[model samples]
Target chain A: MSHNTFPHADHDPRAVRLAARDGTLVGPTAGLAKGFVQVNLVILPEAQANGFLRFCQSNPKPCPLLAVSEPGERGCAALADDLDIARDVPAYCLYRDGRLDQTVHDVSDVWRDDLVTFALGCSFTFEHALIQDGLPVRHIDEGRNVPMYRTSVPLVPAGGFAGHLVVSMRPYRASDAIRAIQITTRFPQTHGAPVHLGDPALIGITDLHSPDYGDAVSMGDDELPVFWACGVTPQQVLMDAGIAFAITHSPGHMLITDIPDSRVALL
Target chain B: MSHNTFPHADHDPRAVRLAARDGTLVGPTAGLAKGFVQVNLVILPEAQANGFLRFCQSNPKPCPLLAVSEPGERGCAALADDLDIARDVPAYCLYRDGRLDQTVHDVSDVWRDDLVTFALGCSFTFEHALIQDGLPVRHIDEGRNVPMYRTSVPLVPAGGFAGHLVVSMRPYRASDAIRAIQITTRFPQTHGAPVHLGDPALIGITDLHSPDYGDAVSMGDDELPVFWACGVTPQQVLMDAGIAFAITHSPGHMLITDIPDSRVALL
Candidate 1:
């Protein structure tokens, strides 16, 4: 299911966590833990935790749940033995009254006993699988960010987190697109599979080059644009919900964990 | 690996053989027996048998081999019991020097000890699978033939049998195309997944409406044409090779075998 193997695909989640905690790794977490999982971090008050959990359950593709910490808890033993959610991520985004407040390197100063942590699966795992299978991921090949767009496809409603879906795009020839579907289907905890492909208009995207988020990758002739659910959907949901105070990992900055990428594969 | 579940999918290969032998079924074998495998029949003299077998082995996508009879033997118990290659199929086409010699209901009148039987898997099983999964097969819904095209993608050469790949096309929306690919990949014996999709000109087909064989189906604006390696490729190969004497099942007149379609699924 998950073709997670890569050259020197070995990393110590504990070491990376320690580095983040010591304030030495304050940049993007990419290439830090190759075979381990990196997740999107979301911190909200215990009052809104149940609703957010339901939101993830209702829309698994975009918000595939890796782990959710208990109210005031800092560590999820299922992901790592000594994980600290507030200090483990490279960077955090503080949103006050549904508006961007400030980006910070550490959350220890603002940490609250009522804060709940959520770790949502990201596309880096499936992207690794696709690469192992020799499928060309256009954005990666072009040395740019994956093109992400807000789609009109509505998510199954959840308490206080209702919104449309966001998708990450990759262009491939017809046959490779098919193989990518099979490969991604095995990883249900990581956005399972694609929600749409080919025509962008059918999914309400008016322009391919004008992506709502991430850099737009060029499409070669005859290549079909395949789309997968993105973790950014949860961020969109949070903004739409107008939460009083919430925190999330800055884009490209993630929480590195001990969970092997292969552990999430269903098959 | 096989997903061989079907309610009342039981069918005796011997009974279908008996019916065809008695002329009780003189037309196409479509829907005569459900959940069982049906095969394209090919009969050639021992002199040409080796080359034909090699051809199928070389071009697995187009000519996936199911079973081959020993010289002077018509029974392949692996597929069915009491099978008669000369009379089992509903119809047969005898080719002479690459030309259509004659169409016959039964070849028992001209049966010879040197003639060898070769059975290849048909697409009926995969079509059944796709329909079971609720993917629309355009041809069946429209009451028309699935469009066929001769692609410039050349097949691997084996002995005197060599030619371009022939593909059977079905139009689908992008999401369905991804699902179709996953479904068909599990059935390698049934032409295992599609070879090409999207733009026809990329595969050397000049027009989608003008196919080399079978009737053309209409394509909607958002629908992409997905192509699978067709069973007709071996027939085309035989014609291209200009074999002196060869026999094949007439269109839609397949040999019903007791082997369950799920038996061919690779999971």
Candidate 2:
């Protein structure tokens, strides 16, 4: 389906992904897919699947597992019945021996029998929640990607996977910061509550303006920087561990799922 | 019964209040009755009761009404069955013509037939919630009364009740401050959530060390001062309005009630 054919593209995650799958939508998936769960996709060989699963379990904040596909399975029945591993996502990164081989629009040509797909929860769910709660999400308002940084905080090593934490920055006034924490605490599947807040330097982020990934958003004088464990964390760990034959969704391009946001609220 | 002889002093609200009624527990009712709702008492003549009730309705964050007794009645059945208005509170401040006339142990001798007692929900309930959530409450840790300040933020006026909003200050690290907001949001009866947070100067508090009332606890370098609506707000209004014949519970020495803390949780 084309983007114009789906007028309510932002409301339906499936429709948005379908448009992206058809090459009609190639830009970032920030505002699109409003109420549904958008996930970080990671495909690995059978040998590293168990190790990554253990890594996710150990560091739940960064790698909050939503669903894991059986080896060679293209569809995750729990997320969406019509989901195709090869063509559903807009973009994917192919890795070989821990180095980037190429970026592709479709992974159908490289689909392997021993590959396993993992769908981990992303921060978009909580960002939607924060907006609903009348809290200003700086990055979204500024029309830029949420700035992310590599932190000094280390994740618990699982099997062979090990790396420092990756966090996304969102600036909010102190009162709004508190409210943001409260709203996000309900959605544990979506990276849950914030990892740290205030003083970017304390978390090893040297400068707020110079982020490692994504565009930096404006911060007000009274605003405090709130940090959430980013889904990019897993990719960083995978790269650091020098894993062979892995795939991840390109930054800001996610696997749109059928799960409603309300379904994940702990309350 | 002495404080030591009160068998259910730690577990039961009824036992603790009964001890206070029997002139046994005259000290601060902070730790004596855990999990029970302690209230800030205010007794005014029938002529001023309507005005004060309107005042509370207009400014709920500061003067959350737990229960109000009927005119000439010495008991509030909604709050407790055997609650004696005259003698249950450990101490009472008698105001004549808006002046501090005297401090009385009991108001039985001067109790007017047209007197109406208002039991305001106290921060003690929400403070218990914060402590239970593993948040470090500075005032509680230091064994001092929460610092109170008179702010420039004006309260909505109702008849003779009009004055600046009075707030209680508690310093917490940014993360703990966020958690405190969440925990306090659950207890709406106990002043609900914080009115403001971060810089004390923003809320019109001139100096952190010099408080208008109560002892100022040390705020660490990493901590931000969070301000909640103090139950002393009504007293401040009464003093400002210069009302005739108003009585309030002495600060920190509140009326131990039979209402359980769980009864006030909104969730």
Candidate 3:
């Protein structure tokens, strides 16, 4: 969790992946592997893969699929050169019968041949782009996690996966919000543009300070809360479905990929 | 300005221009030629043309130059194959010594050898794109002119041409505002994306119901007021400087050109 002295903070994606595998880096992967895509990792039995794939397609704003692994395949060649689905992610959350059973650094001991790995696009990519464009991201500036809320906006039902959408909020001045929308629209894979802004109550978020997940950042009097669909929705959906077993990267602890951020940008 | 029974409403750009030139179309040219570029015409003597050109370059959002004519030239071939700048606009505003002298149908009698014409892009181009994308434009839907206000935000001065920026307001729900920003960003030649949103007081506008120019439309309780740098700015600047003599298209009465709307779109 140390932001200052993390040894692998400035390393490349491959090094970051290796460090995670070797147990040297077990913290959030926010600042590591700059300019590379970091993905949310989801592993479930092959029997549930098809249903989840359909769910992702139905809810792209929340769960944009980056790559999918064949059953029992540890590496997703499309996402990385030498990725191990069981160990490359910094932290893993094991769910049993829809409840979080345990949080671990590696899931190698529980790896099964029937497991299918799903790599999903994360907001970190677009955040990097926003910062590069000189737009201030409130959470990053405050050194806190972007606040997330469960909205009344329901996702399209596909198979057994169905749940209300979860969105991450960033506070910005009106002019900055417009520019942020334009900048994020280019990276559709990374949540794209904001789904809603201005009134949090419109989306069923009762209070801005009390987020369902992540820490809430401060909002200025002149700033409005802009919300983007979060990558956490699929995990929430899986939990809601009461799946027998599943594995996912712990929130904010992503799998660094070899793919450059520019590859995913529309223009 | 009968919205239902305009003979040249569905006509081509050339036909609309011909109607204006022949004194058959003396009303506003909002829907005269669909899918064609409409411009704000500014005609001034050669002595002041260089300063105005520099002003346009300094502030692109408010004054996007589409074409410029040679001194005393009656037509700009770059904008249309057959066109007459002095008589093609539906209405002309003759300003004498920084004051509104009179409104006329044509300026052919006043055309001089030392006069220069500047064609600036208008918001009609992007409004077409927004409607095609299924976004509701409040003013367009209510059949009222877009409300414009003079803001405290100053223009980048060039020579003697300088004035506060004028902006057009459109009220939209936060979600639509984001989509509108994305759509307008593609047409930078037509004022581009909004300069401000949410607060009118931040830009020095005190009242939403009473605009400095144009009719105010109703804003829903959930809507945010989005502001764009307006094309009326150049004419306002000319008047503020008290130029000896100048001719400009009257508000809402534009010059229809042969250039298609698609050509001005960035993507």
Write candidate 1's Cα lDDT for B1-267 as tens digits.
Answer: 111221123446667677678776667666657888999988899999998888888888999999999887877887798888888886899999998799887998788889888899999999999999999999888887778889999999996788999999999987798788889989999998889878889899999989889898888898989999999888888888888998999978899998887899986
lDDT of 3 by residue, B1-267 (tens): 443456876798998888889887888988778999999989989999998999899999999999999999998998997899989887899999999899999999999999999999999999999999999988999999999999999999996689899999999998899899999999999999999998899899999999989999999998999999998888789989989999999989999999989999999
Clashing pairs for model 2 are none
True contacts kept of each: 0.60, 0.37, 0.69
lDDT by residue for model 3 over A1-267, one digit each (tens)? 443467765688999888889887888999998999999988999899889989899899999999899999998899989888889888999999999999999999999999999899999999999999999988999899989999999999996799999999999998899899999999999899999999888889999999999898998998989999999899899999999999999999999999999999999
State TM-scores per candidate: 0.93, 0.93, 0.97
- At residue B123, give the lDDT of candidate 1: 94
Computed on C-alphas against the true complex, the DockQ of each candidate is 0.53, 0.46, 0.79
Mark the 10 consecutive residues where model 1 chain A has the least summed lDDT.
Answer: A1-10
Higher lDDT: candidate 2 or 3?
Answer: 3
Candidate that scores best on lDDT: 3
DockQ of 3: 0.79
- For candidate 2, what is the lDDT? 0.84
Q: List where candidate 2 sits over 4 angstroms from the true fold.
A: A1-11, B1-8
User: After best superposition, candidate 2 residue B158: deviation in angstroms?
Assistant: 3.6
Q: Once superposed on the true structure, which residue ranges of model 3 sit more than 4 Å away at CA?
A: A1-4, B1-4
